[model samples]
Target: MSSIIKLCSSLSSRYNPRLIVSRFTVQPRLCSSVKPSSGPSSSSDHDLKASHKVDNFERKILVWTGKYKSVDEVPKMVSQDTMERARNRMRIKIANYMMAATVVGCLIMVYSGKKAAERGESVSKQNLDWHKSYQAKADKTEKDYASKFEHMAREGAEAAKAN
Candidate 1:
């Protein structure tokens, strides 16, 4: 039992199942010794950093739980075998959900881009049609102006000759 407890404690430290504090000591103050500047907690920044880290971890756990809607914390109040099985089941379920969601999201993005490309191709075709119509009208106008110029020149020459 003692060995089991020690093992559990060791594993907890390694996995950080929860926060732990270390012991501290104070020096014996003499008349010449200046008064201590601050308490151990106040003097050490480790506590602040540890708390921040713990908070971040807790937030991540909360988010994961919210998204999955089901998960169990370690040291579960059940048989060890049952807890292990549950954890394994949860891991598999979460993995499947994440993979399915990712695949669906990727598919949606790909199809959306394909739709946009199709729309762009249709718009380009319309623009090409407009260009072709405008070009045909311009060609007809140019031909009409050329024929009028030639007719005017021929009539002018004939009038001069008669004069």
Candidate 2:
């Protein structure tokens, strides 16, 4: 740890921030004379309108994402690449939330199933018991119905003989 600290201290002493700032001096910039290089053109006008629309849309996205308070707070010029990056970040955030929800759901299911198992309650066992009881009840009902039909036929034959 001391060696690392000594190395950092030595590097900081050798680094001169003022020299770096002086080497990279800011220069004044000049733009167009606020006049069109060519006469008014329909294509240029359409391009400007389209670009403005794209910027406005990106600005709205930035504001909606909480990066800015309002559209006015966003910059006038924003690149398509930057907008795409913001969209990706939003998508990732949503995906993370979905994943977390799925994880929580799975945990709940697992915990409940474990507790049920501890109480000797199994889905397969319940299904098996239900099927056994249903089959037995169906068999008994069928036998009772068959016996009643036999007795009825016998009574009908006796009545015909007496007639």
Candidate 3:
């Protein structure tokens, strides 16, 4: 604890915020030397990349998965098992999301329906009322169009008689 406190004090004394260069100021590097990479993550990534080459036995799995029509179409140097595993993981994830969404939608529907019931809103009654109103509107429009058609027919007949 004492060493930690001493280290903190030393760091605090070394880096004074006011003495430091402002964010607006740009300072050129004192040393232009660049160090070589130790190659930790890169080496592991390369190994994983190289591991993707599929064995001849695993090629059939890829073909069975419908990703390729036949073994001949399957790539000789790719990891089919890894691709299949990734695809399966993705499918499971999507299925879980869809299930969750369905549950949420059902819950929302139930809550909204309950609220509407409280407000005396009936879907069947609303539908019947809508149809009734629509029919009334249709009847009114038909009557209007019928009168217009009758007037047009009379005018047409008079014109024919004049001709």
Candidate 4:
């Protein structure tokens, strides 16, 4: 009978341990050290001092780089070969684009001139005479620009060699 009564008491306590734990464990209170300040002046002053130190450190690093940090930090100028390759690529791209544009413009002009001629519209005392005139002018302009560019390139090469 005594063993049976002990078994019953143990079963009852196992099912309700929360009351036992709460009665024995102590709850913790908040600490005073981490509480927020009641005023703004101290906080602002602290922030300003932090920012000033950061600025001073940045200036020191800049001065340490060289007399003028910007001038010293700049990478050396590109090599002439690299520049020449870039220039050549750019010129080729420009030439290709200009050629494409010129072809497109000529096609458009020819198509329009043909349409006007079909409609019996007289331009410059002859039907679609303006087209021929503009074609001649365009041919001359292209030749002139080509010769000028070639001359400039030759002169530039000579000047570079002399230098």
Residue 52 accuracy (lDDT) in model 2 = 32
The full ranking of all candidates by TM-score, starting with the best, is 3, 2, 4, 1
Q: Each candidate: what lDDT?
A: 0.60, 0.72, 0.72, 0.59
Each candidate's number of clashing pairs is 0, 0, 2, 0
Runs in model 1 lying further than 4 Å from the true structure = 1-76, 121-163
Question: How many clashing pairs in candidate 2?
Answer: 0
Report the lDDT tens digits of candidate 3 across residue range 1-163.
6775564456457764223244988444322135767775765665555456676666666665566788888665654456767468667767899999999999999999999999999999899999999999999999999999999999999999999
Backbone clashes (count) for model 1: 0
Sort all candidates by lDDT, best to worst: 2, 3, 1, 4
Error of 1 at 120 (Å): 2.4
Residue runs of model 3 more than 4 Å from their true location after superposition: 1-78, 156-163
Comparing 1 and 3 by TM-score, which wins? 3
Residues 1-163 of candidate 4 have per-residue lDDT tens digits of: 6775564466456744222223779444321225768765765654443332223433333334332265344223333443344446666766899999999999999999999889977566574577789999999999999999999999999999999
Residue 146 in model 4: lDDT: 100
Q: Evaluated with TM-score, which candidate comes out highest?
A: 3
Model 2 steric clash pairs: none
Model 2 misplaced stretches (Cα beyond 4 Å): 1-64, 67-90
lDDT of 3: 0.72
